[model samples]
Target: MNFRACFVLLAALVCLASPALAKTPVIGVNQFVEHPALDAILKGFQDDLKENGVVVEYKVYNAQGNVSTTNQIANQITDDDPVLVLAIATPSAQAQVAATRKNAHMAEVPIIFSGITDPIGAGLVTNLEQPTANVTGVSNQMPMDKHVAMIKRFMPDMKALGVLYNAGEANSVSNVRRLKAAAEAQGIELIEATVANSSEVTQAAKSLVGKVQAMYVPTDNTVVSNIETVVKVAEESKTPFFCADTDSVRRGAIAAVGLDYYEHGKQTGEMARRILAGAKPQDTPVEFQKTLQFYFNPKAAQRMGLQVPQEIVESADVIIGE
Candidate 1:
């Protein structure tokens, strides 16, 4: 080919690829757990944002359940000066908030959080529908009304419900309130048993012995970090327990009808994409998942001597190995 023609062809190719060559929207993700529901949320968030034409460059960071480490990691995250951040869980979300709050210059960097039960209660925002600041995102905080429905499906005769949660966490408090309301609406008595820290889960679970018909474990950071202890106690007591997260179901809980946390991440990703597309976080309304998931553990059911209806089991996207 002639030199001029070759040059023209090459120029055309570069011009055509301009949009694809654009710098990806740099985003930092802070996560405290590597569980399935949360993983699903992240996967969905990434896929949705990328599919929407956002060029996102992701740097996934794990906080390892240490608030101090999470805070430190968030500080390091800001060093990259990412255009946006996705905080996966409560601690991760708070870490992002702390990092942004600690530095005035980076205040404009918008954060979209997922898996946070109560953004306002957690002091992340002033309101849900209309965030009055440079932050907004989706929440995988399981709906209490839905948990009530799940309970009825599993144990039609269940009259009393017990909840174990971390009393200090805003998300746990929000969940417990909603859970109590759901139990009330369903005409069931609700019992409260709480732990102050990871070391207190066994004692907390033991406290619920014979006082409640069934137990509901909220997606509290403290309880989740120590699920095995609670599981062991419940197993020994033969008390049927339900988790607020799918991961808990997989690990041991009989079942959980809750938000698919990872999908929550994907949903958050969509929100982040919108902000990256020039939509201000303050202008964008808080997003909620339109769908929920039911994760059941056949093994947990068998061990607890609980009979989960086959229909419900069949409906589960996940049935942990018995």
Candidate 2:
């Protein structure tokens, strides 16, 4: 072959072999912690995107339960200039939103959040229907009334309910306020215990020992991350522990009627795909997980010295430790 022909062949080989030569989309993920539910959400999101042919170069940053670290991670992600940012929890979402607001370039990068209970209260978005900004995603908001009603079904004559949550988490704080109102409306007293971190969760659960008839856990990232500690205390105290996250049911909560984090992530992934396909985040309305899942643990109930109700067991979508 002539020199020119040989050079042309080499150029074609380089184009085919060098992935770096092609423009691959980059997606930045900011995760609050390595909890089961949040991990499930990330898995679902990635699986959905892969199925939908959305191949993205991922840069995942974990805050590891440090709320302050989220701010630093957000700043680092901003520097990466990814095509989009996926914030996995409330703290992660808030950090990315704050970073976006401060940096002009970051402001243009769309952010999609999952596992956030109260986006408006967190100040991540102005409106749920129309975000009016470059941010919109899924909200894992469970029905407070329904959760209270389920607790009533288990402990019909219960007078007081205990709750453990992270006071610093906006999602937990907002959910606790709603739960308090719901409890009051039902004439049930609520006992609250706040924990700053996972290490303090056991002490927080112990504080509620005789105060509440049953213990309820909200979708607090911090509290849920160390749920086994709370569960161990509740089991020893013979208090039926309920959760607002279905995955916690498997983690030893007596039961839960809640959203599935995997499904929540899948929905959030779809939204991200839409954003990648030229849909504006501001125009895309925020979505809520449509299906409510029932998860009951017979072993947990038995450990709490409570028998699993036949009707509840029959109706549960998943029965852990059957």
**Per-model root-mean-square deviation over C-alphas:** 5.6, 4.5
Clashing pairs counted in every model: 7, 0
**Regions of model 1 farther than 4 Å from truth:** 1-25, 49-56, 309-322
Report residue 176 deviation for candidate 1 (angstroms): 0.2
- lDDT winner among the candidates? 2
lDDT of each: 0.81, 0.92
- Candidate 1 clashes: the total is 7
Per residue, candidate 2 scores C-alpha lDDT tens digits across 211-302 of 99999999999989899998999889999899998888988898899988887888889999999999999999999987998888998899
- In candidate 1, what are the lDDT values of residues 194-233, reduced to their tens digit? 8876788899888997998788888787788678888898
lDDT of 2: 0.92
lDDT agreement of model 1 with the native: 0.81
Q: What is the lDDT of residue 194 in candidate 2?
A: 97
